[model samples]
Target: MKTVVICAGGPIDELAPLEPYKLSDEVVFIGADKGSVYLLNEGIIPTVAVGDFDSLSSEEFLDLTNRVASVKVASVDKNETDTDLALIHSLDFDPQQVVLVGVTGGRLDHFISVLNSVYRFQKDNPGIQFIVRNKWNEMRLLTPGIIKLTTNPQLPFMSFFAFHENVEEITLTGMKYNVSNETINIGSSRFTSNQLLDEHGSISFSSGICLLIRSSDQ
Candidate 1:
């Protein structure tokens, strides 16, 4: 089944777009403390809530315990971050796709860490599709394949970053600005932000991994 695992980090500001995509049976909420309050406020109860309750008040914690189907509480002193643990648990269900929400804002460190974790998961499980969505942008990790992207006119910025050393034979088509037979390496910001010319664009890489960020100013 297609499951969207919502991580309990960052601000839950862009959750409206995600409402229609949520499946009652397949939705999993990883409430990292106060995130439970966000879910409750939205009138959506999580199927499984996992996190340390440090960010929530006693009453909020109690409310989540009562409302959620199952609660997996962790210690404040755990090796993995709450979001990491949540992602691991989500994978246990063997979902077709995992979309992480409320995971891209606030502290810069946390945001980078979450993106790194997504790439790590992609490396580990090549078949699974994972994405991070926010109000302004949608980010996904790509590995050696052609990907078709449909542009939202409101959100015209499309960028690609090579996460590895040898990203070879990268090509783009249908974009206002295209790259051809390019080698995008780590530490290079050459492909930072570009505009989409058409309704759709495509990207292909012969080797290595890249992170694609499709964003908008408005």
Candidate 2:
């Protein structure tokens, strides 16, 4: 399966560790705007760079252009953000999984936009594994389906939130706070901070989208 990892123009240092994904040949990396600078600095060359690149200095932009073989430059006045452009570009690669890094911990507006964006992205493109990962959290959006998850000792806390207006008939097994046919409405916090009881767990829902967050205390 092909995987696309997008490094966006957020706090790069806050992204989850990169080592685990570096060795995979199936993974393609793309840099969005200032993210190109971070990727180049880390010695991780991008398959392509996309964005208006307004955040980068002229010299840094030049350096990025010189380093990357393919660069898609968007006009500064474009309506969509750099990360949006990057996500659109990612679909062309026909990736099985798309991991978004450096996409959190920025402006409040941007962070909120990203949250909505991921849900719309998943709804538009079903069957694709879309994830947003940072130092403390790994998040996934599930749409009315059965999701099997393995317990990660590193990330001890697991939480679920209703992404849509009403997520119905929700069920969870093999978890510390298991539920059966429960309904979670949007803006509710009842399902937050649950734990995986054993090596694996399963979550199922009949309707509406669910946001699953796996996180660490540290």
Models 1 onward score TM values of 0.91, 0.97
Tens digits of per-residue lDDT for model 2, 1-218: 89999988888768777777788999899999988888888788999999999999999999998989999999999888888888898898999999998988878898788878888889999978899999989999888889898988888899899886689999999999899999999999999999988998999999999999999987
Let me know the TM-score candidate 1 reaches against the reference structure.
0.91
Best by lDDT: 2
Candidate 2 regions exceeding 4 Å error are none
Candidate 2 yields a Cα-based lDDT of: 0.89
Q: Global CA lDDT of candidate 1, please?
A: 0.79
lDDT of each: 0.79, 0.89
**Superposed model 1: Cα runs more than 4 Å off:** 14-16, 23-27
- Considering summed lDDT, which 10 consecutive residues are worst modelled in model 2? 12-21
What residue pairs are clashing in model 1? Answer: none
Q: What is the lDDT of residue 173 in candidate 2?
A: 97
